[model samples]
Target: MKANQPMVKVISSGKYAPSTLITNEDLERLVDTSDEWIVTRTGIKTRHRAVDETTSDMAYKAAMEAINRVNYDKDKIDLIIMATITGDQMTPATANFVQAKLGLNHEVMSFDINAACTGFVYALETAASLLQTGRFRAALVIGGEQLTKIVDYTDRNTCVLFGDGAGAMILEPSTHERNQAFFFNAARGDTNNTLTVVNHIKMDGKRVYLFAIDAMEQAIRKVLESSGLAIEDIDVIIPHQANERIIQSVSKSMGIPMDKFMLNLSEYGNTSAASIPITIAEYYDQNEVKNKKILLVAFGGGFTWGSAILQL
Candidate 1:
C-alpha cells in the first residue's frame, strides 16, 4: 500500500514431473515398509523418480512451459531465480545452467536460493522486491529438485518422503490494484541439526512435525494480519507437500477446512522447493484463478519458514 511500491503479478505458471513412477509397492522391494503404513502416516501413495534427469533439466522444462503459457518474450525476461537444494553442480548456480538451456542471449540477473522447502517463497519475495524497483520488467522464478538422487533408498523413513519435480512462474509488473502480492519469510539456525541434508536427508520426524505445525500457523496468521485479510477472505492455500499429518494438524489447530488447501504430495511426495509452485501450476491448469486471492506457505530444513499471498 505504499505510494512508490509497485505491484507484482504472476503472468503464468508451469510444472513438470519425471515419467518414472515409484509406487509404495515399488518401495516395498527396497525398504521394509508397507503401502498401508506409508499411506496412513504420510499420505504418499506414489512419487516421481528422475532416472537420468538433472535438477537443471527439470527446471528448464518447467520454465519453458511457463514462458510458453503467456507467449512471454524470453528476450525481455531480465531476471531468473531458481530454488533448489539439489543442484547438478556445487560451483555454478543452477540458475546459470537454466539460463543457458533456455537459450537466453541477453545478460540477466540469475541466481539460486537454498532455503530448503521454503525456497520458492523466498525467491518470489526476492524477485518481487527487485521488480518493484522498476529496473526489471519480468522474472522467471523456478523451484526444482531431484531429491531422489540424494535419498537413501534403504532408509524407509526419509526415502519414501521425497520425489523429483520442477515448477515455474513468470512475475511481471502489474497495473491492477488488487494484484499486489505480500510475503512473510523467517528462519531459524538449526545448530542441533533437527533437520539437515549434509550426507542425505536425515530428520527427526517428531521434532520436524512439531515445528511444521507451529510455523504454518504463525506464517498464515502473520501474512493475513499484515495484508489486512482474514482467513475467510483467502481462496486457496498452497503449502509445501511435506507430510499429510503436518497439514492436517495445522488445519485443525487453525480451524480451517482441509479442502481449502491444495495438495499433490499423495502423488509427488515432498519435492522440497518445488511443492508449492508445482501444486499451483497444476491447479491453475485445471481451475480458473484469475483475480482470486491465494496464500502460499512452507516449512523446511535450516528451520526456514514463510508465507506469501498474491492475486492471479
Candidate 2:
C-alpha cells in the first residue's frame, strides 16, 4: 500500500433482528392483506418485530457482535455513528446510548444521522471520510430502527412494508493495495408528500416505487463511474431491503443479473436504515468476501438515496 493513500476498510460486521416473527398469514388477521398478495408484490413472507426492545438495545447487540467477531479492542474505538429514523429518545443521540451500553469509558465522538432507509449508506460514507482524516484509528458504524413503532398498522399498505432490526460494522485504516471505498449520496427535499412519517408512515406507493428505481440505477452508475470500475467488476450488490419489485426493476434496467444482488427482505422486511448493513453482515457471515468488490445502493423517504463501492 502507498504511504499517502488513505483507505478506510471494514473490519467486521454484525446484525440483530427481534425474536417476534410476523408472518404474512399473521398480517391477514390484523389487516386486509393476504400471504399471496404480499409475496407476489414484495417478496416478503415474514418480518421481525421488536415487541419491547428499543433501537439502542438492538444497536448495542449488533455492535457487540461485530466487536466480538475479531476480539476487537474497545479502547481503540474513538468514534460511533448510528443511523436511524426511530431512535429511543429525541434528546440525546441514539449513538450516545449505544456507547454507554457498550461500557466504553473513553471520550468518543458519538452521534446519529437520520436519512430513512438510505441512512446506513450515508453513515458509512461519513465514517470513511472521518477515518481518512488520520485522526481516528477505528470507528463503529451502526444502523438500527424500530420502524414498526412508526408504521400505521391500520393501513395495510405501510403496515406490510416495514419491520424492526439493527446492523453494525467496525472500520479501520487499511494497508491493502485495494482497500479504498467510493461513495455517491444525494437527496431531494420531499415537497410532494410522496413519502413521509409525520404522525405515522404515509406514502404514495406508486410514486415512491418510481423514484426508488430511478435512484438506485443512477446511484449505482455514479459509484461505479467514480471508482473507474465496470458493472461486471462488482462481486456483490447489497441494496436496501425495501421492496422486491424495486430490486427487480433495477436489475432489468441495468442489465445486471439478480444473483449478483444480496437480498433478504423476504425474511426481514423494510428495516429502513438497518436493511443494507444487515444484509451485508449476513452476506459476510455466509460467504467468502476476502478480496471482493461489493456495491451498496439505497433509496428512502427523505427522497434520500446513495451508493457505495467497497473493496474487502
TM agreement with the true structure for every prediction: 0.98, 0.97
In candidate 1, position 142 carries an lDDT of 96
Per model, how many backbone clashes are there? Answer: 0, 0
Poorest lDDT segment (10 consecutive residues) of candidate 2: 1-10
Q: Put down candidate 1 lDDT per residue, 123-160, tens digits, no spaces.
A: 99999889988788899999999999889888889998
Question: lDDT tens string, model 2, 138-256?
Answer: 98999999988888988999899899999999999765668978889999998998999887999999999999999999999998888888999999999999899999999998899
Compared with the true structure, all predictions reach lDDT values of 0.92, 0.92
- In model 2, which regions exceed 4 Å deviation? 1-6
What value does the lDDT take at residue 127 in candidate 2? 92
The alpha-carbon deviation from the true structure for residue 284 of candidate 2, after best TM-score superposition, in angstroms, is: 1.3
Clashing pairs in 2: none
